[model samples]
Target: MSSNLAGNQATERKRRIEKYFQPTPKDSLKQIAVALLAGGGIAVLLGLILLSSQSFLAVLLFIGGGYALVQGAIRKARYKAEYEKAEPKPSDREMDRTLALDLQQIEDRAMHRLGITADHLETGAASWDPVAALLADKMVERPKKRPLVLYGPKLSDFGIGEDGVWRFKLYEVLVICPTVHHLAIYHCSLDFLSGGLSMEDTEEYQYNHVVAVSTRTTPAPADLSLERLNTRDPEDDEVRFAKVLRRRLEVSVSNGQSIGVTVGITDEQDSSKQAVLQSSGIDEVIGSVRRVLRDHSRP
Candidate 1:
């Protein structure tokens, strides 16, 4: 009785989670059987109706019906066997637990690759926000801790992708601390797409090596960072509605270290609301950079 109850529960759970999964072999086979059986029955019916003058056609239809019926029977039997056997264990999430765990390990490894030591970050004054961090650490340029700051392994957008496979572009962490005669920047820029971190080579450099700093705010299309990579299409109403405001603050080093961050506001129909919110966020972050530039303020 207990075994039967467990099997029924498992089946129920599988059915509930079906939306996240592809149709099973059993379900696929069953559907195929339904279609083929209907086709076969129709053929047999037409064959019987045409048996007099359409005798040859009737015979061919009979043969075709037999073939379809045979295939349908085979599929039905397979589906029955599968149903009787068992359903696959289901998860509430689309990705398996093991895959999720492995993906986390990949994130950790990727962070390490960028030369941001866990110990160094842990010892910093500010509590580490997984999305953004103003960190205190010894950098390659300074080779000491006190005078340096690392801004983040921050995401362009916060929140998961709707389809369980979202992408977030990791912004270039800024390095402008107070009282330091020259800034020492560490950049690990790239995209984290579809549960995998697709990152560039981590770079470290001094302020004097910087070639330019450019900043811009513009109307953005559907979020390229959070959504899957898609070519821009002709703007329909929905596409135009997805447009929000975005700001990019970029600094380029002499040796090809392009450090930048792109931040944007939530997409909503209220244009004024979006602008106000976006400007607030952009100003808060950009103000820190501006302060560092203006009078070497501690951030």
Candidate 2:
């Protein structure tokens, strides 16, 4: 009984969300506009014919008809612009596939660099943390020794509102493996938006050198820099009213530099897309980083 109630409540919430984006019915608006235009045309013609004798009535007709015509034209124009979406293109599906392939390549590269065998990895013996379980579920190779990873979208910002509320994401994967003396972090970026893989970057941070780890959402900078990172998360009106929003997660490291992962909920995205954009995955990855710092960072 409780489960059923929860399901219904969820359904209602989604319905409300979808409703917020919807405008007046396109067909209804178009029909009313056409009617007004036709009526206004007839009224103007009658007024012109009666101007010689019925001047007062003709003047009234002219005023009313002109008002109706203007109103109708305005409404009609709005409908045309708001309803006429451009034809769907192959680029959407192609982009999705391209991103997937790029991410897969980076994951493979990380596994190879970390010395995880290609034969297979058993999740049964992997870390029980949610992030580890998720990595294990990939059936991909991950170092069994204090393995951790921080991965998310890189900065993606486009000038066009055609992306709607959500901009596309280019992913960066950071695979961290701890050694007796230091932590070897293997990282790479996959940018399918334009094309091709970014060069792999591997750096070793001594236990004591490693300092802070965090995840935060901030306004995407025009230049994608680390400066001026202070900003509040978008709320009800802020999200709903904005035409486009480019968001990224800033991950701070011991080094002066920080990395960004693209992830967030945007106004125009539906519930399913919103779920996919949830920051939970990013948070879990951060959680893994913290665990590593707690257990292995220079004491």
Clash pairs (backbone) in predicted model 1? none
User: Over the stretch 77-178, how does candidate 1's per-residue lDDT look in tens digits?
Assistant: 888765543335243233233233433344455445544544332122321222221111111121222222322224344222233232222423333232
The lDDT values for all models are 0.44, 0.50
Model 2, C-alpha of 3: deviation from truth (Å): 54
Best by lDDT: 2
**Which residue pairs collide in model 2, if any?**
153-261, 153-262
Q: How close is candidate 1 to the true structure, as a TM-score?
A: 0.39
After TM-score superposition, what is the CA distance of residue 188 in candidate 2 from its true location, in Å? 3.3
- Any runs in candidate 2 off by more than 4 Å, and if so which? 1-101, 113-151, 155-169, 222-255, 265-280, 297-299
Per TM-score, the best of the predicted structures is: 2
Q: Model 2: per-residue lDDT, tens digit, 228-292?
A: 11111222232332222334544455667655445553333322223133122555445555666
